[model samples]
Structures are given as C-alpha cells and as structure tokens.
Target: MDVLVVGDANPDLVLRGDVRPRFGQAEQLLTGADLVLGGSAAITAAGCARLGLDTLLLTALGDDVFGVITRQRLEERGVTLLLQPSGDVPTGLSVILTPPGDDRAILTLPGTIPALRPEDVTDAHLSAARHVHVASLYLQPRLAAGLAGVFARARALGVGTSLDTNWDPTEKWESITDILAYTDVFLPNANELRAVTGSTDVDRAAASLVATGTTVVMKNGAAGARAWWPGGECSAPGRPVDVVDTTGAGDSFNAGFLAGRLAGLPIPEAIGWAATAGSLSTRASGGTAAQATRAELA
Candidate 1:
C-alpha cells in the first residue's frame, strides 16, 4: 500500500438545499438528500486510490446497511480495507446539511468510531506503506488517546506521517500539541490553526506549528492553501470551480498534496495539484464521486 489511512468510517446522509428544522410535531421537506460513504479518512483513502496509489484503509465498521454501503464504495474506489465489523456497536454516521455557497453544518454520531484502538494499527501496517495519514483526530477518542505513540512508532519505522485533526467536538483542542511534533505533514484549516495555536494571526499560528518541524498546510478553502516550513512559505490560489458541496474537499486536498509529495513533485506543483483536486471534488455533492484520477489530473 502506498498510503495507510487511519480514522473513523461512516456514511454521510447529506441533505442539500436550504435545510431547516421544524417544531416538535412538524417536519420540513428537503430538495435533495443522499446516503454516501464519507469520513475524512475514507475520502482521503479513496482520493489516493483514485490517483493510482495502492491505498489501505484501516478502520472499524459495523455489520449494518450503512456499513455495507461504505464498504462497497471503498472497494469500488480500489481501496483495500483492513476493516472489521463490531457486533456490539453500530457504524458511525454523519448527517450533513448543505445550504447555499457550499457551506455545511454537520451532525455526527460517533458509534464505532471511538472503539478504534492503537493496538490494531500494527507496526507492520506502518512498515508497508510509504506514508500514513490520520484523519479527524478529535472524533475518535481511543485513537486520539494513543496517537502520539502510534505516530511515533510510524516515524521510528521510517514511515512518513500526516494528520488532519478535523473539528474538535469537545472544543478543548487538546493532544495535538504533542502529536504535531511527530507529524511530517500537518493539514489544518485556517480556523483550526488559530484555535490550535490560540493565535489570532495566521502567520504566528503557522510559525508556532512549523517550529515543531512539521510542514504546515493551512487550508483556506476559497483562498486555496498555504504551506509553511521552518523559514519559508508559499500559497496556492484556489481553483475556480462551480461549488456543489464542500464536504470532504479538505480531505481531498490532503490526498492530492500527499500524493504529489510521494511522487516527488515540487512544493508549488503539489499545492497546485491539491487546489485543483479539492475544487474539482466540489462538482458533485459527495466527496469521492468527483475525485479525479492521476490521468485526469494530468
């Protein structure tokens, strides 16, 4: 496997078109809705597989209808699954409401997500893949608890590592400070960078993270992304595309950038690829459907 992705696995129940809630006894209609395979890690693995990498997805699922759908989609995308079904807990789920301007409000149910253990993420898995990507750090409590040890083990095995510590539900934004030092590729949105570093300024926040020897890629959606190293930084302008849905676009961007780096592309070219990959993914409602392959990227 070229990349090993570790995180939650779930199906996204997406509701599009001005969605709103009604009172206790009332119900509203939605213009569109679909059940699709989604999760930051799953999307990244699908993106990498589509871009021609041998991708391995390490996560847990449940023996349910949603899990079946998730597994099918991942397999169709050529991702080798190292997933197990838990009899006790149901699979995770996300209910997304996408309104105008590609904005989304998400309600996530963490079922089997918190059950993922660092022990399952074996050192052999780390040795096989050239790179390992961990997503949605804050969602999985068990995984996040041992992330530093897992990441440290990956590094000790000479495997490259990346982390997309998605929104912290608890709002505490803890544990990332130590793990950042073990991360080779750290992807965070502008807001996350600020929240994690407790800085009102982007430059200062990025610097705080960069000083840990991790290359920080700050995602700014419409403004594209910026990458900062020890003493240098570069920005990639956003790709102009008709936005359909922004869900998982950042995960797709991480996939593109990591793919570029693994392929030995220059930083500028890699960020360009990431911007394009992310923008193009918005052409469809879900994350994986519109992802471009390596041939398409060319």
Candidate 2:
C-alpha cells in the first residue's frame, strides 16, 4: 500500500522519573534518558513501517543536530523522507517527562515544523499514494491551513484520506469543520474531541463529527475506542497492557488501524488491532519504545 504521512517531525528526549517534581523540588530519576523520533506523523510513519507498509513521510526539519537525527532515524526505519529545507531555525524538540505511571507531559518547541507548506507536497506524492494520512493539523499552520485543498486534490487522484487530529492550544476547532468535508476518516482521542467540539458526550460528539462527512474514530485511551459511520457504530475494548509511558500510543493506534484497513479487515477488527498496538506502545520508556509490529498485533 502507498501510505503518505504528513506533518510535524521532531526528536523526543525522554526523561523517566519515579515521581513528578513539585515546584523546585528535585526528584530521583529512575531511568536514564533515551532520544527517539517523535511527533504524531513521525511516530505514525515509523509504526506503519513496522507494519510493513510502503510509507512516505512529508515534513520539515531544521538544519541542526536534532534534524539530522530525525532524518537518519526515518531512513533507518525505511520510510521515505520528503523533507523541506529549513531556513535558519532549529529542528523541533520535545522534552518528554514520563513519571513512573502512564501519564506524561511534553515541553515542545515547534521550531521549523510549522513551515511545512502545500508546495512541500508535490502532485506526485499525492498521486502515488493509495492512502494519505494528515497529522497534527492544528500544530502546523502552513500545512494545516491548506489541508482541505490537499485532501481535495488527493481525492481527485483516487486516494483515501485520514486525519489524526493532534492538539493545538490555539486551534480554531470550528474552522476544522470545513476540512472534514474532504476527510474520509477522522481519528481523535477523547480529550482532543472534547476540546474541539466543547462536549463530553461521546455519542453526541461522534455524531456531530460524523455529520461533517467524515467517519469518526473517537479514541478513549485505556477504555478502548469507538468507530462511528453514517448508518452504524462499532467499539473495541482496550486491552490490558502493562503501562509504562503513554506517549506515542495514540499515533501507533492510527498506524495499526490503517494497517488493518489496508489489509481489508472489518472496522471492528481494525479497531481491535489498533487498540492492541496502542496498549503495547506503553510497555517501554518513550512513545515509540514498545512499538508493536504487525506480527505482534496479529
């Protein structure tokens, strides 16, 4: 399958601690840090590669050390890198603080990631893909602003479109309504959906999101996920995986779900596979640490 993943690219520096420090209070660090390729698109693309897909990643990275590492990692994963030249800015970096529990916080810098534009993605890139996944729409303005047009073009080229609605504090969620008109499948976690739609009712929110002409997969972490189409809905219960860090779980879920779809599995089965991938992702230090392969999912 030809899968295109576009959006943010960053290096994640994860520091594992047993307890979160109080304001100025120092805590003992249990595990040493590990640097890994992160960001929604990057993790998703890596997971896709692990699933044995022909994946292409379109993104922007700065000319710094972090950028170099990001590119090298992508190449090592066998993902085609369609990188745009970043002017003077540094590559994006996320300082991931993962406490002993499953929760974590990210201190991130967009750096050159916000510069990915429509011109960065060529007609060839769109036409060559059977499926295109647009990620972090709210975090990358240039790409995010032009997403609807991009999806429309991809559709004309007979490509299916999926969107991973990563969070943006300043996102105009209502504006995203228009983009869904061209999106075939919409993937969002529970919190992201709540923030975007300003509602807590999953059914109501899923219905509202699907009303905009997109199939909705409302991801409720740890509790499993829900998939809503026009005529029907399906849900898969979350598996009990030993939780470590909850960083890249959602992105991996997207990869597993897409992999299932490409393999011609039913939606319910796809969601089950997706949840398994997500749950397995939490067994290590960082987001991609415990990434599961297709064989593992099966």
Candidate 3:
C-alpha cells in the first residue's frame, strides 16, 4: 500500500551527557553524539520506507542548511519527498539530550514545520496514497486545525487516515473532534493518550480517545502497546533488546504497526511488529538508526 506521511521534518542534534544538569548548572559530557533526521513524521516515514513500503513525506522545509541536511538524510533512506519550500525561516531543529535511561528533553524551534497547510497538500498527492499518516498535531496549530478538511477530502478519495499526536496540553482538545471523527486510526503514546483524554488508566484513556470517533492504539513504551475499539482490546509486549537510545522508538512503532495493518495482518500481529520495530530502533544512536527492514521484521 502507498503511505503518505504528512507532518514535521526536523534535524535532530543529539548530545549524550552523564547526568542531566539543573537549570543553571552545566552537565558532565559523554561521548556518543550525532545528528539525524527526526520529527515524528520524518522518522516514521523513513522507518516505513526501510521496511519496504512505498512512502512519501509531505512536509515543509526551509531553504537553509538544516533543511538541506534533513532532505539529504530522507533521500538517502529512499523515502520520497513532497516538500514545500520556505525561504524566510530556517528549517525546524531539535536539541535532544539523552542522559542514560530516561525521557529526553526537547528544545525545538517550529521553523518551517509548523507552516504546512491544506493547500500545501495537493489533491493529486492526497489521492495517490492508500493511507495518509499525519503526525505531531499539537506542534502545528494551523495544520492541526485544518486537518479535518484534508481528512474529509482524503476520505472522499477512499484513503485511510492515521494520527500520531505529540503532547500539547495548551490546545483545547474540543477543537480536535472534527479531525478525530474522520480518522480511521489514532496512534498515540500512553502519555499522549493521557494528554489528549485527561485520563490515567490505560484502558480508560484508550476508551476516551476511541470515543472521539476513531480506533485507538496507545503506545505504552516498555510495556508495549494497547490497541482497542469499543468492545475489543489487544496488547503487545516490548521486545527485549540491548538499549542504546530511545529517541525514535514510538515513531518506528507507528511505522511497523501501520505497515502490518496495511498488509492485512491482525491487530495483535500488527502490534507485535510495531513493538519489535520500536525496540530494535534503540540499538543505535539517533532516531532513524537501526530501523529494521521488512525481512528483519518478518
């Protein structure tokens, strides 16, 4: 199936330090540092392409150095690009500091990523894909608000929809209803589910999100993922692999799960593919590192 990934594309600068520093203090540095193409959609699209899918990235990139590097990285991975070029501002960039086994803090500049609009995605592009996955909704207000119309148009053309929401407690979730109503699949991590639904229990959170008019898949990190609908619940365990970095695991999981589902696999099997892909992604540095191929996933 052809997959169209619509969302953020940012260059990720990773710094490994021994201990996370306090607000005013400096940190002890560790060795392994590298740059990679990140942002939820970019990573997921690259993962999908690596897993042998026909993938296209519908995103905005600045006419700058970071954008050049980001585009080069995506092209190197064989993911097709549908770029909307921006000349006024630089491309989005994220500074990620991974201090051993924990969640990393991200400092990002929206740059060109938040500038994507419905008009930016042409009908020819939208109609060409079987599935359109748009991610990081909270990070881009205009695109997030405009997604309902895009989904409506895609639905008219018989294309399925998926959303990988990033956490933004600031936006009113009420505004997301229309877009969610048209979504075929909703993919969010456990924390994101809570942020979107204001619930703590995994089942309750998933239920609340699914009630918003789409099937829910809650990515529960090390515990695996929970896929649910009105009357059914399916869980997949995380694969045990030696860890290096947890940067792009969730995005890779989204890629694997969607790839499996598009191939007509059962929900349980899809989650298994997702979990393994997510786990294997951490074996190397950076978000796109160590992403598995279709053969490896099989």
Candidate 4:
C-alpha cells in the first residue's frame, strides 16, 4: 500500500435541511436522509484509493450491518481494509445534520472507534506503507494511547506520518501537542488550528505548530489551504464548486496532499491539489461521494 490510514471506521446518518432538533415534543422533517460510509480515516482512505493510491485502512468496526456496509464501501473505492471487526460491540456512527450549506452539526457515538490499540500498528502495518495517516485523535482513546509508538515505529522504518486532529468533543486540546514531535505533516482546518493553539490569529497559531518542526497544512475553507514549514510557506486557492455537503472536505484534502507527496509532487503543487480535492468533495451529500480521482484533477 502507498499509505495506511489508521482510526475510526463507521457510517454516517446524514440529514439535509434545517436539522436543528427542537424540544417540547416537537417533530422536524428533513428533505433528505441517507446512511453512508464515514469516519475521517475511512473517508481519507477511500479518497486516496479513488485517486489511484494503493491505500490501506486500519480501523475497528462491529460485525453488524453497518460494518458490512463499511467494508463494501471501502472496497468499492479500492481501499485495502485491515479492519478489526468486533463481535463484542457495534460500529461507530455519526449523525450529520447539514443545513443547506457547508455548516453542519454532528453527533457521534464512539462505539468501536475507541477500541483500536497501539499494538494494531505492527511491523506488517508499518512496513507495507511509505506514509501513515491517522485521524479523529480525540475520539479514539485506545488508538490515542498507542499513537506515539506507532509513529516512532513507522519512522524507524523510514515511513512518514501525518495526523488530522478532528474536532475535540471535550474541548481540551492538550493531548495532541506531545505527538506533533513524531508527525511529519499536521493537517488541521483553520478553526481547529486556532482552538488547539488558543490563538486569535490563525497564522500565528500555525506558526506555533510549525515551530515543532512539523509541516502544517492549514485548511481555510473557501479561502484555500496553506502549508507552512521551517522558514517556508505556500498557499493555494480552493476550487469553487457547487456546494452540497462539506463533511469530508478536510479528509479529502489530507488524502490529496499525501497522495501528491507520495507521488513526489512539489509541496506547493501538492497544496493546490489538496485544495482542489477538498473543494470537489463538497459536491455530494456524503463525505466520500464526490471525491475526485487523479483524472478529475487534470
């Protein structure tokens, strides 16, 4: 595999329209509701596979209907699955309430997402990939604990690693700071970057992370994405497309950038590819639905 994506494997129960739930025995209606393959790592893995990378996804799911659907979706996108299917628990699930634009509210049930341990990244997992990516850190307790060893082992084998710290439900962003030392590429959207750093200035927040010797891919919705490293910075304007849902835009960007890097594209050019991939992802109701392939990019 060209890259291995480690983290949650789940399905999204997405509803489109004004999805705010009211209290006092009120009922709401939505124009559309669909169950689709989801989870940050799964989406990115699928995106990479669709873009022609030999991608492997290491995640945990339950031996249930959702898990079956998840496996089918991943395979349909040509991703190699190394999933841990648990008979003891159910698959993770996220409810996405999209309000006619990019803005969305998500409710997640952790389930088996927190069951992946560090031991999951063995010699077989690390040796088969040139790059390894992990997402949804704050939600995966077991995976989070073993993350350091995973990165270190992958590094010792000359493999690069990236991390996408999706929203922290607890609002405490301290757990991820220590792991940046092992991360080669850190992909975080502008809001997450700001909140993680507790900085009002996004650029300053990015600088603080870059100071740790990690390349930061700062994703700014519509404005595009910027890559900052030691003494160098590159930015690209996001491609404009018909808006649908923005669920996996950031994960798609991560896949695009990593695919570019693995294919030896220059960093600036890769950021442009990432921006384009991210923009294209919003054209569908689900996160991976409109993911672009390498041909679409041209």
Candidates in order: C-alpha RMSD to true structure: 1.3, 2.0, 2.0, 1.5
Compared with the true structure, all predictions reach lDDT values of 0.87, 0.85, 0.86, 0.88
What ranges in model 4 sit over 4 Å off? 23-27
Tell how far residue 260 is off in model 4, in angstroms.
Answer: 0.9
Candidate 4 lDDT tens digits, 58-168: 998898888889889999999998977576798889999888655788898888888888897898899999899999998887677778778988889999999998988
Across residues 81-183, which tens digit of lDDT does each residue of candidate 2 receive?
A: 8888888989999988877655678888989878888667777989888899988887787787778888888888899999987887686664576678899
lDDT of 3 by residue, 11-76 (tens): 999888763665666656577678998899999999999988899999999888998899999999
How badly does each model clash, as a count of residue pairs?
0, 0, 0, 0
Measured by TM-score, the strongest candidate is 1
Model 1: which ten-residue window has the lowest total lDDT?
97-106
Q: Per-prediction TM-score, please? A: 0.96, 0.94, 0.94, 0.95
Question: What's model 3's TM-score?
Answer: 0.94
Q: Find the candidate with the highest lDDT and give its number.
A: 4
Off by over 4 Å in 1: none
138-208, model 1: which lDDT tens digit per residue?
88877888898999999999999999999898989877877887999888998888888999999999888
